[model samples]
Target chain A: MDIIIKDLCKSYGENTVLDSLNAVIGKGKITCLMGPSGEGKTTLMNILMGIEKADSGAVENMPQNKSAVFQEDRLCESFSAFTNVKIANDSLADDTIISHLEQVGLGDAVYQQVSTLSGGQKRRVALVRALLAEKDILFLDEPFKGLDEDTKKIVTGYLLNNTADTTVVMVTHDIDEASALGADVLYLKDGKITL
Target chain B: MKNKSKIEKTIAVAAALLLWQLASVIIGEEVLLVSPFKVLVRLSELIFEKEFYSAVAFSFIRITFGFVLAVAVGIIFATAAYRWHWAETMLWPYMSVIKATPVASFIILCLIWLNSSSLPVFISFLMALPIIYTNMLAGFKSTDTKLLQMADIFRFSFKKKLVYIYLPNIKPYFISACSVALGLTWKAGIAAEIIGIPDGSMGEMLYNAKLYLATADLFSWTVTIVCVSILFDKLFMKLINTMFKRLEDL
Candidate 1:
């Protein structure tokens, strides 16, 4: 089912973020929310993911089970890469997780703590976790922020291949990222959305 | 570097013992101060006797039980206080009172309310509860909001939240509290035993030695308590560190 946003509006103290915006997020497709800084690209995703509330609007038909790669690599610092992913789906087999970690070029650091991983490596771990989790909708807020050119290409390819059939909404300032994922671009500006 | 530190430690200890021996010789009064050599001799003799082990073991069991019970209660209270604002407010006065009240006063008052045998355990528990509770509560409060939000987004179960999020945050607090509380419980427990004069206790033996002016016996028992307390502290800390090590490795 597609997610429908109807007159979604939000304001913080005095600054209006979403001024009666509306959009429809198609199911099983990649859509990227692109905008300048502080334009509520993340705010809209947070509302849809139920992490934040809108002042006066309705988000309809959002999936019950949601997964996200937050702007920050919110991986548990002391836990292993395997454990961080396992926390999302403990029922998943360890070998499967190893395979996924291998795909992301983190095979050596599989059993190492996330805190020990570099920024790009930690981002890959968070990406792998969300990508492997059992969720209907996936949210990505600058998920690949810190990778170099080569690593970003490999990760972008992996993400595209893996999430081809999943509903993914990503927020990125890099329009090239939207192009690489073959994702539909929605520009958020002035509390309004332009697709 | 390790060998250097070891040599430094040995030299420091030797200097301390030499000063202690010199002080004993200068005093020249057996009633007031027992020499280190004589205390060592008395300790060796006491170890050969059955009553020494029995007394030491008994006190160890009661005090350890009290410390463990207090840890359990402290965790529960800290969790409750973290979850509910009113619970924190309600416990504020009680925590303040327990922290401020003297151990001797509590032991004497508890002696009136409880059996002499259980007095040490109760006192140890009372002394340890506030420290553990306060530290663990601070840990809970300091948990990262971002990680919590990640947990919420992933819909993590309580078990996962605890293992991945809460345990890591609380570990330092828990270990520090245990270190401090372990030493305190031993001191407070022995004090309670000395005052309550429970039969077949190390504290009772110390009281008898004091009453009879047997400074050697007093020094021997004091040395024994120090050894036992240090030994237990080392073992407990090693176990805790190893457990966390395994947790991290996992």
Candidate 2:
């Protein structure tokens, strides 16, 4: 089911974040939300993911089971990459988890703790966790923030390839990354979206 | 570095024993203070006596029971308090009173209601409860909110959230609370025994030593208590750390 947002309004005290915004996020396709800081991109994602609420609007058909690579790598620091991914979908076999880590070049550190991993490595683990989870919707918030060009391409390809059929709404500043994912782009400006 | 520290600890202990022996000699009165050698001799004799083991075991069992009970109950209540604001508010007064009131007061107060045999258990439980509850609750509160948000989005079960999120975040605080509480329970428990003077207990032995002014017996029993306390602390913490370390591996 596609997520449909209508007349969404959100605010923090006197500061209105999303003032009567609307968007139809297509199902089984990547929607990249691009905008400057302080725009409603993240707020929209939060509302759609049910992490936040819209004061006066309706979000229809928000998937029941969802996963995300948060703006911060929210992986458990003491757990290994394998464990972090397995934590998201523990029913997945260890062999499958190992291969998923292998796809993102985390095979070497699959058993190493997330705390010991570098920033880019941790981000990959977080991305892998999202991809491996048994969820109908995936949210990626600046998911490739720390990776270099080569690793970014590898991880981005790994992400898109594995999560082809899942509805993904990703937030990023990189238009090139948005294009590379072959995502339908939507730009947020002052609580309004430009498709 | 670890080996060097071990050697340094041994040297420090030897120096302390030498200072103790010099202090006994300078005092020059066996009634006032017994030499380390004499205390050691008394300990060896006490080791052979069935009553000594009985007293030690009696006090040890009750005190340990109190500490274990406090830890289990503290964790349960701290979790509930973390979940419900009113539970914390309701418990605040009792926790404050337990923390502020003197252990002697609790022992004396409990004496009127409880059997003298149970005084150590009750006193130790009272003394250790606040430490565990406060520390564990702080740990629960300090758990990363963002991670919890992520967990919610991912639809983690209560058991999964506890194992992956709560356990790791709260471990250091839990260990610290246990470290302090273990020592406190022993101190307060022995004090209760001394006051209550339960039969076939270490408190009775301490009371007898004080009444007869048997300095050797007093010194020997003091050493026994210290050894027992230190050993228990080390062993219990090692076990806790081992379990957490295993979780980290997972």
Best by DockQ: 2
Chain A only: list TM-scores of all candidates: 0.98, 0.97
Docking class of 2: high
What DockQ score does model 2 reach against the true complex? 0.86
Off by over 4 Å in 1: B246-250
The residue pairs found clashing in candidate 2 are: none
lDDT of 2 by residue, A1-195 (tens): 788889999999988888888888899999999999999788888888888888999999988989998889998998888888988887999999999899999879989988999999999999999988999999999999999999998997898788878899999999999999999888988778866
> For candidate 2, what's the RMSD?
1.1
lDDT of candidate 1 over A1-195, digit per residue (tens) = 888999999999999999999998889999999989999999999998888999998989988889999999999999889999988987899999999999889999999978889999999999999998999999999988999999898899889878967999999999889998888888999999976
Error of 1 at A117 (Å): 0.9
True contacts kept of 1: 0.92
Instruction: Write one digit per residue (lDDT tens) for candidate 1, span B172-214.
Output: 9999999999999999999999999989999999999999999
lDDT of 2 by residue, B67-178 (tens): 9999999999999999999999999999999999999999999899999999999998999999999999999999999999999988899988999999999999999999
lDDT of each: 0.93, 0.92
B244, model 1: CA deviation in Å? 3.1
User: Just chain B of model 1: what TM-score?
Assistant: 0.97
